[model samples]
Target: MIEEPKSLRIGPDVGRRPSVEQVAAFQGVPTGFVVDAMFGVGAMCVDISPLDTSNVQVAGPALTAENRPSDILATLGCLRYLKAGDVLIGSAQGWQGCAAAGDRVAGMAKNAGAVAFVTDGPMRDYDGILEVGLPCWCTGLNPGSPFGTGPGQVGTRVMVGGQPVETGDMIVADRDGVVVVPFAKIDDVAARLGAIQDMELELDAEVRKGLVLPDPIAALLDSDKTEVM
Candidate 1:
């Protein structure tokens, strides 16, 4: 038979986090722009959304945790690893029957310097979480409580919302959804963000000026490649 495992596993702290200046670059930036910078990727699954629209936009380094279904030991353990401006991410293997976190947990995260909380599983105590003032994103809410059991890991990589997120990765989220910018790609994504923002602004202006069909689509319709049927 297998031996008993440790009640909780906490990995080493993230050795490299983006500079405050780099993290600030994403503050208040729309999730769409971040996704565009990542070549139309990096978005979390559509189901995970903000607990409230009041505090939707958030950007910070990720502090990741992974827990078994209907359990929250890993999430609780991650608090010790959280740094100021960190975004706490908990992966519950997509379990929705029980909440991965609740109001008290949100309060703890906020006190621990976490700017936001995100999980692939549902949460509880919606009103209390909002009052705690920690921005949160999850699949939904469930009154069911989770156990503080073992078989969980903290301060390591975790898969949240179908995306592989690790400590030190940048997490940018808003009312739209959450997006992850891998730690290795932070500078690269930042470099490309300006160009994407410029292009988006230009397109928005054109659309506001009563432009209907885009140039590419119109050209395709008028060219020999098109056939009327």
Candidate 2:
């Protein structure tokens, strides 16, 4: 008796992607604020960072891929779903020994108009990939090739960098790091960005004047039920 092969589950493309203009507005905003104070949650990837420190920033709707360990067929299949403002994010189960992509795939993804590529797994062709000029964020680089075997999914919710992501989620990435904003929260976050930046700038100006820690910190430390130990 022969074992039946596992079937690949490809979800349909989401009908709605967050506004490209609105998402792109987050390009200059620090991921620190977006993740720490704005979103008020951990939507940032803990292990993912840009492969090249080229002062590049990327913001776009997500095109998600879930690849089986050591296999990237679903990633290849996801190419058709790419648009001018899409970021291809792959969940490779956090595998670090095999590359999820390389120069060839990165070039193809760029040609398809993808703004960036991200993966929980490593990627190959670091120098060549940077030369292609597509922004990439990943755990690291590995030279091992992935199998083309089936049994992966595309355009579906997947886990990457310890965060759950869905297709069309707004992904804002820069030198600081990648921050994911759910589609439902994109507008809300965008609306709050201005006020947050305003306050941050005001506070920065005060600090630059050699101002010491403000009354809030003193009050908190002085009170605290008066416990000094």
| Strongest candidate by TM-score | 1
lDDT of 2 by residue, 143-206 (tens): 9999888788888898888777889888888887788888788877887887888878888999
Model 2 quality (TM-score): 0.92
Error of 2 at 168 (Å): 0.6
Judge candidate 1 at residue 100 and give its lDDT.
91
**TM-score of every prediction relative to native:** 0.96, 0.92
In the range 69-144, model 1's lDDT, one tens digit per residue, is: 9999999998887899999998999999999999999999999999999999999998899799999999999999
User: In order, what lDDT does every prediction score?
Assistant: 0.91, 0.83
Candidate 2 pairs with clashing backbones: none
Model 1 weakest 10-residue run by lDDT: 9-18
Clashing pairs in 1: none
Report RMSD (Å) for each prediction in the order shown: 1.2, 2.1
